[model samples]
Target: MLMNILSIGSQGGWTVAIVGYSIVFLALVCLVIVFMNLPKLLQLNLRKKLVKEGKPCAEVEDLNIEGNVNAAIAMALHMHFNQLHDEESNIITIKKVTKNYSPWSSKIYGVMNQPR
Candidate 1:
């Protein structure tokens, strides 16, 4: 049965190829359509949720330039103070490490010796 199927002549091969390609292209087109509309659908759902929550559908604009200026000034002051500070004398140091490996310490060699 496998040999019979594999022995499909030139015309049968072309027919199978065309059908397979058509199915793949049709699936791709369907996916493209769904993806293209996905963002719009999500936005509509968001708008609906916002409306249900009594929030405005329109986006709010940030109008406070003074707040931004105050934040910038605060950051600058913090950086200036940090730069003027001195480092502490206390420090941490790694002293020593020792490693000892023995054949009896590991079971990997025993497992490797087992027959598959």
Candidate 2:
């Protein structure tokens, strides 16, 4: 009975495959739709929760200063720290040293007991 039901050449097998694929496709479509609207849904729920708790749901605004004002601030900061700052100095320097590769350098090899 099981062999008859699972036979690939039979109509039952094709029907089962079609039904399985359709259900998976539908589930994937539903997941895609849910994910697409998830952010807005979360925001709405958050706003509702905030209102219920008697808290403000105001959106935060970004600071948009003028370019001239930014330049002035930068100049003021540079002038204030002029004495402490270095005009021509290396921030970081890396010196490479050549070393022969050895298995003993690894932690696994180091864990082995060695005779004195």
Candidate 3:
């Protein structure tokens, strides 16, 4: 007896539907990830642009004026961590402001803003 070769099992509609939905679900997941990370991507792109424009140590104000996102972030970090004010009035202002701020308030804000 010779075996027939033309007859074969094929997938049903339900199986095809499930596979199609799964692919769509995966694509949506990827899109969500990209959307969430879009800000960081733009920031990086802006930084490269600032560098190309020969701008260094760009601050948030500068970035804003230049319409560059990366420079704003770089400037913010610089002011927060590296920049210093030498004026006596500024020192007094910081001291007086902190003196009036409650310790609990400081603790809460500090904890909330701490780097991960």
Candidate 4:
């Protein structure tokens, strides 16, 4: 069926077009799936639900402090790259994350930097 569409406008160009479109379409689908699962992938949804239910009072930073050192390291990168830089909007957007587990609290200092 899709092959027919690609075959529509040109003479054998359809094969190339079809292949290109198929690759693009597949890439897009993968992207959508990743985007949809991003929240869960980051455990953001779980954190939000827990917070709303009052079952968990701990923020991510707290968890970072308590959890494995590797997780803490990962979260550190997560914080640096994921933090919002828009001072005006004041919106912190985490890519691939759906929920806000912990509100930003005291300043976070990277390993080499002095505490803020």
**For each candidate, what TM-score against the reference?**
0.43, 0.39, 0.38, 0.32
For candidate 1, write residues 4-83 as lDDT tens digits.
Answer: 77677864786788899999999999999999898668678877887899988774223224558989989999998998
Q: Score residue 103 of candidate 2 by CA lDDT.
A: 81
Highest-scoring model, lDDT: 1
Query: Which residue pairs in candidate 4 have backbone atoms (N, alpha carbon, C) closer than 3 angstroms, thus clashing?
Result: none
Between 1 and 3, whose lDDT is larger? 1
lDDT of 4 by residue, 8-106 (tens): 877768678789999999999999999888755567766877788887646644543334878888989989886676348667887885665553432
Regions of candidate 4 where Cα sits further than 4 Å from its true position = 1-11, 44-116
What are the per-residue Cα lDDT tens digits for candidate 3 across 1-116? 12232233453655777899999999999999999898667778888887888887364235444437768978899887754664355443334433575677676667558666
Clashing pairs in 3: 59-75
> Which residues of candidate 3, in runs, are more than 4 Å off?
1-11, 57-116
Q: Alpha-carbon error at 106 in model 4, in Å?
A: 66
**In candidate 4, how many clashes are counted?**
0
| lDDT at residue 52 of model 3 (Cα atoms) | 85
Which tens-of-lDDT digit does each residue in 1-116 have in candidate 2?
Answer: 98665674866777888999999999999999999898668678877887898877774113335569989999999888995755657568889999898886867656466756
Please list the C-alpha lDDT of all candidates, in the order they appear: 0.78, 0.77, 0.69, 0.72
CA error at residue 32 for candidate 2, angstroms: 0.9
